[model samples]
Structures are given as structure tokens and as C-alpha cells.
Target: MSSSNKPHYEADPNKVDYDEGNNRWTFKPRGLSIIWGNDRRYWNLPDQSSFAVDRTLNYDMDYDQRSEALSGPHWKGDGSSISSDKACPATCRVPAKALNIIWGNDPRFWQWIKLSEVETRSVGFDEGARLLQVNWIEVTGKLPTTMFNVASTTKYEVYYVMKFQVDAFGWHSVPIKFKVRLNGQETAKNFVLESYKEKHDVWHEICGGEFTVSKNAAGVVEFGMFEVKSEWWKGSVVLAGWSEDDVSQSQQTREETSYSQPRHIEETSTEAKLGETKLKRVEKEAESKAPSGSTRESSRF
Candidate 1:
């Protein structure tokens, strides 16, 4: 037999598409990267670029289109969007002060203000244009000097700060201002508040805004009112923020990681709850006063 008549052999790996889905570009054997060509059109695709010409010619697809050809069965094509859960509703309460409400849900906790109907159009209400309305009371209670020691102690003032948070998937919130009233007297200036969050839970905090009661006022501090402006989507709810001078660094790191989760902030007490403290008379302070004429340093807890 002549040497030219003998069979021919190629020393290269062949490209095989076993799945027919355009994806699954596996070499003939599992680990082989160098694909050999036996008089085939092209050789050594190196990275994706080398295969670009062949992929375009064989499939008549552009680079982008060819790249996506095989992305179906095994992978949900690139750039796919993921849907998220709706935002949960938030509630605020003050354990010591109880406002006039239909029910006292918890006997141990005194809720001074409640703003559930912040939503517009609750059945037969007027128009849905009302920003969240606040219900406040001028209940008598001593300030937690130990817990919030950063606040002024010389002559305590009733500053009303407002903070709020909203739940929205893709919607951006607009800035808004609200009203603060003390004993039926509304302030000329509105309190400004901002939003913040940890993990999935969001909160708003309004600080340094207070109403003052004169030493000659009848009782301790009276119920002063504070309102906030907020935009709500069909799926989101707003919550309150804390009055902390410095936010924890650990909280910021958690936001970037996918493992972030919600955390609860508990009220701390240095001493046991005093039985006599419940009825203790509130001394009238002379110097402290809020822009609003009413007396009482209030916040959304």
C-alpha cells in the first residue's frame, strides 16, 4: 500500500455541542481546552473573542446575540430582574404616655401617639391628600436622664424631633416637611427629618425640635403635636428612627452583604421600674422652650 493511501490522524480536540442549545460548549473530552481542527474553518478560540468570528458566521448572530444563544435551559439569561417582597407596615408607641384611643392594647405599654391612618383614603375619609396626621398628649413623666444623657440637663426643654422611613422597591422618596403643635399653638417653622435603615427594616429620625412649657404653666408638660410628610407606594410603610449621635459601624457593613438581617433595638434601663415614679409630680422648667409655644420634649419612639 502506498503511504498516501494510508488513513490520516489529527492531534487536536474537537468542539462538540451535545445539548444542541447553543450553550454547553464542551470539548470532546471533559478537561481539554485546546480544540484541534482537521481542516476545520478556525482553530484555537483562546478566549471568547477567538470564537467570535466563527460564532457570528455559523449562527448569523451578533456578538451579544451569540453570547446569549445558549443561556436558556441551564441559566436564566443575563440581565434578568428579580422581584422583591412588599414592605411591611411599621408602628410607633411610647410605653409611658397613653393618648385617648379606642383601646389600650397593652396594659404595660403606654402609647402616647399613634399614626396608623397616614395612608390616604381609608374608605369614607376626605381626600387622600392628608400627610400622616399625629395624635399627641401632654402626659406627665420624668425624662430618662441616664439613658439619653447626651441631651441637655441644666434646664430641660421639650424638643420635638420627627424621623420616618418608607418601604419601596424601586421608588425614590421626595423630601417633605411637617407641622409641630404645642397646646393648640402651631410653630412657625417646620421640623426636618431624615430616613435610615438596617438590613431590611427602615426608620426615620427627627431631632433637636422641641416645644417648651413655662414654669408658670399649669401641669408638667402638655400634649404637643408633631406631624410628618411621607410618600407611600402600594407596597411600602414608614417607621421611626432613633436619636443617636453616632450610628454603629457594624450596621453599615451589614448593608453591603447579602446576609444582612433586621435587628431590634430594646429600651434599656439602669434601675428597676419605680412604683412611686409613676405618679411623681413633674417640675416645671423655666428656660427650655420649643419653637412651638407648647411645653414638652417629644419624639416618635
Candidate 2:
């Protein structure tokens, strides 16, 4: 296939649809995804697994969608959307467009790849954003109250759904910036990706902080994923998109919304995310911070 500088998914700017009754905007999936996130309705793997993509599929996994393309049974024709799950009503899937992936339209730094043509087994998403190479990584998006009308005096969190490729680089030395803002309040954090770089090819969620909705705040939430100051070149990460949900509800119903069936998970993604430590944190001397090269396996923030 010939390459184009523009993102393939951006062809249809009006892809997302608003669910008035639910007070949320429906997400459309187009490219490379790591996991199906917490919703089984969106992935090919069996009922239990985190980060909704092919990495979670084991020998016992029942991925019926393997028979055809993501555009079949689960995804839309153009690989632009996820099938709706009524059971998980509060969870909202946001498209990659909402995140405003920087340099997404430029083939030199980023490109969109269609997964169905290259993947042998059932993968995640229809198309994914491919980082060819970049010295500065920045992905930012804003959800206005006009689109997502959340309840007043409630808390919600934003996540950029992504995964690093096997050949991903520059993650160990530089820290990633994840931040979120609502009204005038903002929360941000720096996470060291040293432990995570080696565990490539699996999907992960980096929280861009959380925000509380209030009556006078207007309810607009902004979030981002950035690694600009380090100036180290990084490449080979596939970004699926974004997801949002009530912080309180997620803490309470994680067991229910995490998977379709029950399985024994020692430390759920919730534990990794809400439970924070140096495992994911990066200090002020981040630019020179490198992993000891010790085999550290898991990570969360």
C-alpha cells in the first residue's frame, strides 16, 4: 500500500456520535490497539484479561473474532467504531481524534496503519497510530461539557490507551508527562517508563490525572501525554485512543466492568493504577535516569 502523510482515520471527521440519553460521545476505533481496555465487549480475547488486545490472548483464550477482520463481528465496516455494550453504560470510549495526537498527520513522525491486512491473529482496534520516530511526543485532548455532560460534584478520570512496540525506544531515559484539568484545577505527574519499555507489545493505560465536576466549573476536562524536554528520539508505539469513566464508579465496579467472566488476578490493573509508588514515578533528574537493567516486569500509575 502507498503511504500518505495524513492519518487514514481522519478521512471522516464526523465519525463520533453523541449518545444523548447516556450523556456521552460514542468512540470510533480505527487503528493499532494494544488491549481492549476493561470492556470485553471491545476485545477478541476471552472474558478475563487487562489492556484489551492480542497480547492477552492465551492458549485457552476464545477469540471468536479470529475468524475474520475486526470490521467483522466486532468492529464497524471501516474499522471506525466499537460495538456498543449496554451492560457497561457509564464507560465512554473516545476516539484518537479526541486526544489530538501531535504530528499524527505527518508520515515522518507518525502514520496510521491498518491492522487487518498485517495481523495474523485477532488484534485490537481497526487502525492504530504508528510513531515512525519523534524527538517530542505530545498527545492532548479536551472533552467539553457540551459533549460529555457528567453529573455535578462527581469525579472522573481520563486515560490515553496505548502500547509500545517491540522495537520501541527512548522510554527508559525520559519521563512521560500525564496531566488532566477541570475548571481551574489541574493535576499532573511524571512517570518513568523504565520498567515498562521491556514489556513491549502489550497494551497499557497512562492516566492523565483526574478531575472533579462541579456546578460552576463548566465540566470541560483536558488531558495529555507528553515527553518533550528530554529530546530523546522514540519510536514504535501504537496508540488506540482514549477512555473515560467515573473515578468513584471505577473503584467500586472494577470487578464487574473489568472483564466478561471472572479469573484470578493477583494484582488487578486497578491496583497498579490507583496504587502508586516509585514503580511508575519519575523524579526531577529524569533525563539521566536509566533503569539498572534489572528485569522488572509490571508497572502502574
Q: Which candidate is the best by TM-score?
A: 2
Compared with the true structure, what per-residue lDDT tens digits does model 2 show for residues 1-301?
1123322212122434565775765433322232433232222222113222222212232333331122121111221243334113255666554346655654546767766543312223466777767765777766654344444666666666566777787766655667777666777766555455555776565555666666444556677777655546788787777766677776554454422221111224443343234323433334345334322111111
| lDDT of each residue in 4-69, candidate 1, tens digit only | 232332323334444467654544321233233221122222232343222322356554444345
Off by over 4 Å in 1: 1-176, 188-204, 219-301
TM-score against truth, every candidate: 0.23, 0.53
Instruction: Indicate the TM-score of model 2.
Output: 0.53
Q: How well does candidate 1 match the true structure, expressed as C-alpha RMSD?
A: 26.8
The most accurate candidate by lDDT is 2
Give all candidate RMSDs, comma-separated. 26.8, 19.3
What stretches of model 2 exceed 4 Å from their correct place? 1-89, 116-125, 215-217, 251-301
Error at 163, model 2, angstroms: 1.2
